[model samples]
Target: MSHSTKNSHLSTTVANLKPSGIRRFFDLAANMDNVISLGVGEPDFVTPWNVIEASYHSLEQGYTAYTANAGMIELRQEISNYLKHRYFVDYNPDNQVIVTVGASQGIDLALRALINPGEEVIVIEPGFVSYAPAVTLAGGDPIIINTKPEHEFKLQPEQIEDAISEKTKAIILCSPNNPTGSVLTKEELIKIAAVIEKHDLIVLSDEIYAELTYDEDFTSFAFIKGMKERTILISGFSKAFAMTGWRLGYATGPREIIEAMVKIHQYTMMCAPTMAQHGALEALKNGQKSVLDMKKSYRQRRNFVVNSLKEMGLDCHLPGGAFYVFPSIKSTGLSSEEFAEQLLRKERVAVVPGNVFGSTGEGYIRCSYAASLKQLDEAMKRIKKFINEL
Candidate 1:
């Protein structure tokens, strides 16, 4: 049958969903050549060589078979230990953690496990694109709480409290946040923790960039007092380990919640790729050295791009973690979407429009500094020239 013939029953869920603004802009840039994309918020670094070697060894050792729905016990233990070592959070490997396809699926699973029709999920503005759609797909209302640049794009405890209503179900947080790259201070998280405690809200904390902190040690919501029972901590090897294609990530939370998520997982994914899990297990065990090295390179790029943007008169801040800097182009009196389009057309440089993140994300553009310094230098030169023209 033709697509049009079968398209009639397209679930309203899928039918009504608008494409991600980030991906729309990215798609527009994909066909153009001589283009530099700082848009995709991905590490340009290759997965470390040793991790690849381990994957080969695992397959050669005949380790290619389905694992448990939650994933291999040994791999789970490694993830548990890795969490303890890095974040001081303790979770039982057997019950608390579930190996996911990536932090991406972990987001979907958390939503699937929690949302009911019309229940509100509070999402931080200028947040990653995934949270809203995931919540919507699970039949939840996405309540956006816009955070401003003046506030460093950090969530205020008061704001959280205000957004909550009787129908509120959860709050999804990302920091070193994408687009903006803002890290929440411990004090800020502590404040938010109190509100969640008061409201008893489920917290889905996506901390995939936790290991990329530059200014201070990254803290986990999982480690926060009273959060263990209420928070679902989603993290993955993709960002920190430069293993984006590996498609391995995991979540730790209350057993009941995880068990519920695994029910969805069993039908949706069955199991994460066995070879990828093996690689992720290796990543947890020996990935730290590689993570640190990749982080070192990224830190340099962050400083280079952020500083260059400032020298060119863009209102940008040095972000605390992650490899992106969201710089304001408001002074130019153009919408971020317009600025981004012009930058690509005139300079052939691709950066995500901040408005794509949310309404409050307007007047700024998000550029990932995950590329080589050489590419960044060329891109910066083009950007400087482009801005000068305006």
Candidate 2:
């Protein structure tokens, strides 16, 4: 179809939305040979055998039907218990939890439920590629806050206080952050909470990597004093449980906001997959060992990758959690995109350009340590060679 013809059928918001930069590099790598990809943020581990068996058993027991719009009560209750025990926060299973297709969907649902046209939502960078576009799609303007590398990429309280406006409705926060892998400490969160409470703004806290922290215990933003009632916590089994393909996640928050999200979910997704919900229930009940095991491996890989990048003279931070390392490519005298693309073509290594995450990321590149040590070692060698040749 011609561009004009396609534009006639597409809403301006949908048409204007930029495609995900991560996927673009993944596609380029897909068509190449012998490429070692450190681009995607997904875990390299398989789903735990127990979780898989539970899903299989659900199918055997004839549980293949659509679940309640909010999801199976048993699953929701398990999620509630897990959060309380792990994070010292509580949510009523009946009205305060909704199982989502993925944490990605939970983000979309939260924005659509809370935002009206022309309102603004604060988005920090370098952040997940989806945040700004998701806000735009939900009819909210995204007010960008660029956190500096000197601050360890953690959002500062002053940034939040300065960005507030009458049209500001909510803020999206992710930690251990995706591209940067920076986890916000409890003291830092308390400072941020002070700002949020002072402004009375709602927070959509994405804790999808909650179980993957290496250096410290993960702190739930909702657990901050006076924050639970105003924070929507979005998490899932994807990263920690290595169940990305299962497509299961959830959100817990104030009953009213969760109910509004459910209303939209019922008209759209209906419910998370019934089989996946059953699998996730098992994950919450008995998958702690698997979670810890994967966390151990990720911690090792994180150290190895960070050391490798630093050895090769790339300025890299020791990420506190998650499996990504954002290393500055500035000394190589190349833009983020040029460095990533040329490295892929010449060295057969695929890492995402940092600028795709946000403008503040322009001089850096994001490399995931989620690959095996064997693959990571080889990819690091290739990357070092690429830089040397440059």
TM-score of each: 0.97, 0.98
* Count of backbone clashes, every candidate in sequence: 0, 0
Highest TM-score scorer: 2
How far off is model 2, as Cα RMSD?
Answer: 1.3
lDDT, model 1: 0.90
lDDT of 1 by residue, 1-390 (tens): 333425487877777777788887778888899998898777998888888888899999999899999999999999898889879999899889999999999999999899889999999998898889899999999999999778899998999988989999999999889878899988888988999999999999999999999999888987888997899999998899889988999999999999998999999999999999888877778788888888899999999998899999999988999989999999889999899999999999999998878899988899999888999999999999998999
Candidate 2, residue 64: how far the Cα is off, in Å: 0.9
Query: lDDT per residue, candidate 2, 222-283, as tens digits?
Result: 99999999999999999999999998999999999999999999999999999999999999
Model 1 TM-score, 2 decimals: 0.97
Model 2 pairs in collision: none
**Top-lDDT candidate index:** 2
lDDT of each: 0.90, 0.95
